[model samples]
Target chain A: METPTYNTAFAELEELVAQIEDKDIQLDTLAEKVKRAKELIKYCEEKLRGIERDIEEVG
Target chain B: MPTPKKLSELVNEIDATIRNRFVGQAFWIKAEITDVKKQPDKRWCFLKFIEKDRNLITTEMGGVFWSNSYNQMENFEAATRQQFASGLEITCLVKVVFHKRFGMRLEVMEIDFAYEVGKLENERKQILERLVKEGIAVNPEGSSRYYTQNNTLEMPMVFERIALIASANTDGYRDFRKVIENNKYGYHFSVTDFSTQIQGDAASALIVERLHSIYKLKEQFDIVVIVRGGGSDTDFKSFNDFELAKAVALFPVPILTGIGHDRNTSITDLMARQHKTPTEVATFVIDYNGDFENAVMQLHDRILVTSERLIDRARRSLDTYKRIIASSSPETIMNRGFAIIRSNGKIVVDAKDIAVGAEIETIMKQDTILSTVTQKQDNGNTNI
Candidate 1:
């Protein structure tokens, strides 16, 4: 699968957070979702604050 | 070389002939105004009436508006909402006037306001028709509102790579750059300038060429922005050209136009994804990125709050379980003044369970005592 964009990753993270807050969620599923949510959060954070993104004038 | 004639003699003959032919009769003539020179003190103007065929001047005539006709010019400007200067097409009443020394010219009298307006509107309508025929624009359900393919494209959440199409060193470009470069959020953009003439007859073609150039490097830019500072309607005329509008409408990358005009959205503006002032476009880009950043920050706060809540709840449950286990321990019961007795490795709960002279071990919180039962007596009440 292709890597998710910042927007896509953020959207997924939000869904996982909603599931984590549900009282009836299965513990095993909750654990899996939490792990994926952490990865997504890290991806979005790096995209927003990455120093490697630089400006270059092509013309 | 025909017998030595005075220069005035021949000039007078020509003037007499012209005056006799026109007889001071005002004739309605159609022409484009050019080289208009207005004299504020005299309240009159000098102009040239020209006829063009395919961009080449075919016929030209000197014309004049005397002081008495100044009001007519003002009225025409007011009615048409157009400046009565060079490049204006009009049908005006003029009388042939010949002066011995000044030669011959047309003296302007009245202008047809409707003719001027109708001509401009007709041209615009024709271009719009051609665009529709070419399938470049869609007027859904035959309604007044229409959109082109470029207009239907979705703009990105934030634009980081910019292809700026503008005239070099113009205030619009400078203003746009200033806002983007100094955005409060410090968003960095990679801007490439594709400068071209943005006004005059050749502007549309020049702009079209620049669009093609940007197409070659389309991957380098997220959007193309066409910007120019405010100018007279004539200066913005090129933006209405069919060729330029078609190019903009067919462009693969989204185009944003901010060629300033108080009224009348140009065809190029219609084909673009969005249109606004240069400063406004800059603000929009900055604000879009700001919105995303705000959302991310909010999400981060929510994650923190939720995790803390979950952890606190789990910690409370653990604390309850620890209390239950600690309170049920034998040491805790012994501290409450209870003892345990075992005989033959079994708990002695009743007198029949233990025989006469049976040995037993008594356990208390702090000591173990050894004892033997001499006789067994069963009592209904085993109260201590």
Candidate 2:
């Protein structure tokens, strides 16, 4: 069985993106989402960097 | 050489009754042992027997597995022990020979060992180890690192996704499930098992090739799991190759291995982010995220604490401003308003500070009237 701990920020970011695209979001909410999105972006960037380094080592 | 008693002469003397020497090479003949002996001569083992058939055929034949071929014989027996049983059906490669002293002999060469299942497993392990040491990252899950200008290490936490590189349908699925799904912590993870022979001839190449395939999907995964289930001691040989270890050290996602066997550590284990005894790398990940949760919770608490502190500070600042407004009574200004007059564009602090003919004016909030600075007041005057 999957645990709630398995949900990464990516899932949250995807949700935010969906809300923006599908719902009428308030400007204040948009600002908060943007801030959260920046944090998620940072998380993704770190994940990708780790992958690159691993690929390089394997090579 | 004088023949002691020629079989043909003996038969003719008896009655010339034997027409032919063809004893009908009948192999279905049953025999009961009257005596069994190992001859002093190392070359052959002799058996004395009483034949039971249509006619009384009492005979003994020497049986031999030559010392030169004895090694092959022993190995063959060892391999086929699982299938070899008494009272079993028999089909062997054999030849019949006649000796001057002994009447007849049966020579058997090849014996079947029921099935060649294990033989195939071992050969596959050899190939897997060879491919790994060659410097190709056969197991796509391995550790990696990056650096920033501040010399701070940015270690991104990779979540529970690992591409397990192993043959599907083997013990891969079973072990992975036991570790990830059925654990007390209930760690969740997915395994994309690549089914191939775990051992024997084709195992090595298949494992390495699949490792390459998973490695290509680095962007899609956080880690890689190289796993196989418990088996013989030698079953772990596949992971011992240098190329495999090097591949693990260099994989895109950190490589985690749970090869199952507890023999000497393989090269892959040394190079991996973590090495486990089985596919329960999920347990490790769960605990890792457990720490992460504690950290986030602490952050949440600190935010609450800091907010309280900030609100307290703002309240104190607001109170200081309120006190200043309350103490500033206009009586201070009204005392000066009666004594001073406005002349031209300036306030006349005293009559001496103003000159005659200056168009002075008395001012109050109600009215501004023209006047003359006719008097001066003393330094300590309490005027009426």
Candidate 3:
């Protein structure tokens, strides 16, 4: 699967948080939701900090 | 042509005639100081003054401040808190002198500091009025379309790409780079510094050109920042240019300004999101990204807490269902002194359905007995 953008990752994390808070969510899907949430958080943190060291100067 | 006058004699004649008109007479004159140079002796100040006609310098004159006059001017500056520098509009009392060698020049006698300040204030007010009339200034009723256009743009979750406009070797640019590069969060910024003249005659045009270039590559940048280090009020005058202000106001991307003047807001400052200094602008970017990071951190905590709670809830529910099922098992019921009777391959539920001498099976928890029924019982009466 392709990596999600920061906004997409954040949105997914929020949805996962909401689903986990839901009382009607099935136990079978609980683990799946938690795993996905963790993945999104990692993707977001990497996107936030990942960049080259030098600043590019334009005219 | 008359008498073929000598060059020196004609020059002397002209000087006498000019002196006849201006000698020993003082008049108050209003003009801008285009340049000022202090002599090595520290007692004399030479200045070039110019009269501007609608942004064009139409006339020029030289002026001198002798030691006695310079001392008086210093006292005036101390009282009025305004410095005599280039780009200052001043009304000074001067006596015109036609020198034998240096030609015509004004001799400084006194300065009207209050008048200069009032003139600047008037000019600022006029510019503000023009901006309002042009429908570009912030509306008092909170409905200015142009002033609020760039403000309505959503800041990116992470400021990955930034378009920075500042002089190449300025303290402001250095300070901004230092703060952003050394942010404690380790956030990375892809800064593209568009070095340009930050202040001076060419500053406004250069800044406007940079803005256009950024607009062409607008998608490549997240935000545009214009910053400058501390300078005199004259140096900041370029920021008040109408063209630069208009460009910033109508910029497609969000523009932030840190021109480093805390007292008065420049036209560019009014058009863009203004900060006190370049460092503050960098701090704003850092804090902007930090907010999203903090939010993500909060969400991470929530997910962890909620997942654990959910798993614990599911476990307790499963345990309860398991207990209920175990308690109602057939073996458990049968172990409590009950027997299940079977006849003709089916459990007999009613006694009337079976006749005497019928073959049957009695099943208990540990044993099953094959027997024949010799009696039929109904409600406390037995028939054999």
Candidate 4:
């Protein structure tokens, strides 16, 4: 399975930030955005410190 | 075959003839030294002087430095601050001598330290010139398309998967791992070490091969990092190889180099994002992701602040509307000593609207007074 690229994760985070910053966002949408933001932050932070280390050999 | 002299006799004759030709002559010869071995007594230095054709070794000859000449070589290295080690290109004054036992060997007499430095400088210049000509060197003006190929790649905000090129047993690789693995922010780096020769003649080809492998799996890596621990200038020659530099320049993914030379920059450095050391490269990756994390944190704060301000504004608006509604309410007006009159289930706003002898009701804040209209008055003077 393919993992999300950093760029994709970061772009989603940026969009969430934008939505949260909007003054007219609906409460429901705001909640959704905040939840997504939390998820992205957690995912990114975990990736940054995750203990999964894999080293592959190639020609 | 019968006329051929004995092997030893021919060898002796050949050795004597070669000696007679160069016995008393001494001149400077330039070549790269390898397989260096210093005697335990420190009285002699034995090495091979090699000539290369491109990346391949063309010729090699054994050479020796006697105690006196070895002492001179040490002084030369000290004065120049360049180590006399394997892979060093040196121009040294030597006597061409052929020994019956050792065959052809150059006897070191004097070392030309300046010439060695010049040779290195010249090689660096040539590499730089070629890189510029090939349009692979960095040009701030964006005049060269090839130079911008790897540099212009959009760097990922977070560094998750890294394609690392280094020797497995090197301190550079270890330092890189230590820095990333123990980062304070707990940033995880999915690093894959493509172990390869980091120095010497085959270093360039090995590194290029690893890069090709990574390129094939470019989707798995965000960037390619070429790092090494500190080394002598001679060891860094591989980093300056034209082929390796070209490969780095043309790589699909962005390349980051940390070859660990404080004084000199290699051609590969010009073609890729250069860092001073392996640890610094690791720090760069961490910091890049940290910036994104910080932005997320800042956004979280902004959301809190802006939402609070919005809620406060909404509450104030609701309070103002509530006050307006209360002030205009009929009950509140009636409580303030005003009366409402109704006639036949209809509000009678004017005295003329009610006929004489009509029944009417007066409404107050908490009571209803039933009464009959005895007279209807429309003028200033009224009798009830």
Candidate maximizing TM-score: 3
Task: Tell me how far the alpha carbon of residue B74 in candidate 2 is from the true structure, in angstroms, after superposition.
Answer: 18
lDDT for B91 in candidate 1 is: 96
After superposing candidate 2, which stretches have Cα over 4 Å from the reference?
A1-59, B1-155, B169-172, B175-193, B230-234, B307-311, B314-341, B354-374, B381-384
Stretches of candidate 1 off by over 4 Å are A1-59, B1-5, B13-25, B32-60, B64-90, B107-116, B231-233, B339-384
What tier of docking accuracy does candidate 1 attain? incorrect
DockQ score of each predicted structure, in the order shown: 0.03, 0.02, 0.02, 0.02
The C-alpha lDDT values of all candidates are 0.78, 0.51, 0.77, 0.77
lDDT by residue (B1-384, candidate 2, tens digit) is 875997756645433222233222323333333333433356333333344455565554444445544443345434432222222233334445444444455554543333232443354455444544454434344433211111121334635666767656666556675666675645566656556665543555566676778877767766666677654333444565444444555555666667665534455565564455555665666667667767877987786666556545544543443333222222333446653366777765556777765678766546768876555556677756
Give the alpha carbon lDDT tens digit for every residue of B235-256 in model 1: 5568879999999999988898
**Candidate 4, superposed: residue stretches over 4 Å from native:** A1-59, B1-43, B47-62, B67-90, B95-106, B138-147, B230-233, B377-384
Instruction: Return the TM-score for each candidate structure.
Output: 0.69, 0.45, 0.70, 0.69
Question: Model 3 off-target regions past 4 Å?
Answer: A1-59, B1-27, B32-44, B49-61, B66-89, B95-105, B141-146, B231-233, B377-384
Give me the TM-scores for chain A across all models, comma-separated: 0.79, 0.72, 0.77, 0.73
lDDT of 3 at A27: 42
Least accurate 10 contiguous residues by lDDT in model 3 chain B: B321-330
DockQ class, candidate 4: incorrect
Candidate 2 vs candidate 3: the DockQ winner is 3
For model 4, how does the per-residue alpha-carbon lDDT over B1-384 read when each residue is reduced to its tens digit?
478788899998898888778778998888899998878386899999999999899999999998878886777665444457787788889998887878888889998878766776788778767777777665545343235478678888778999999998788999988998999998778899899988767889999999989988999999899999854434666787889888888888989988887776777887888899999999998888889999988987786666556545544543443344344445666778988888888776678788888899998888899998787655767753
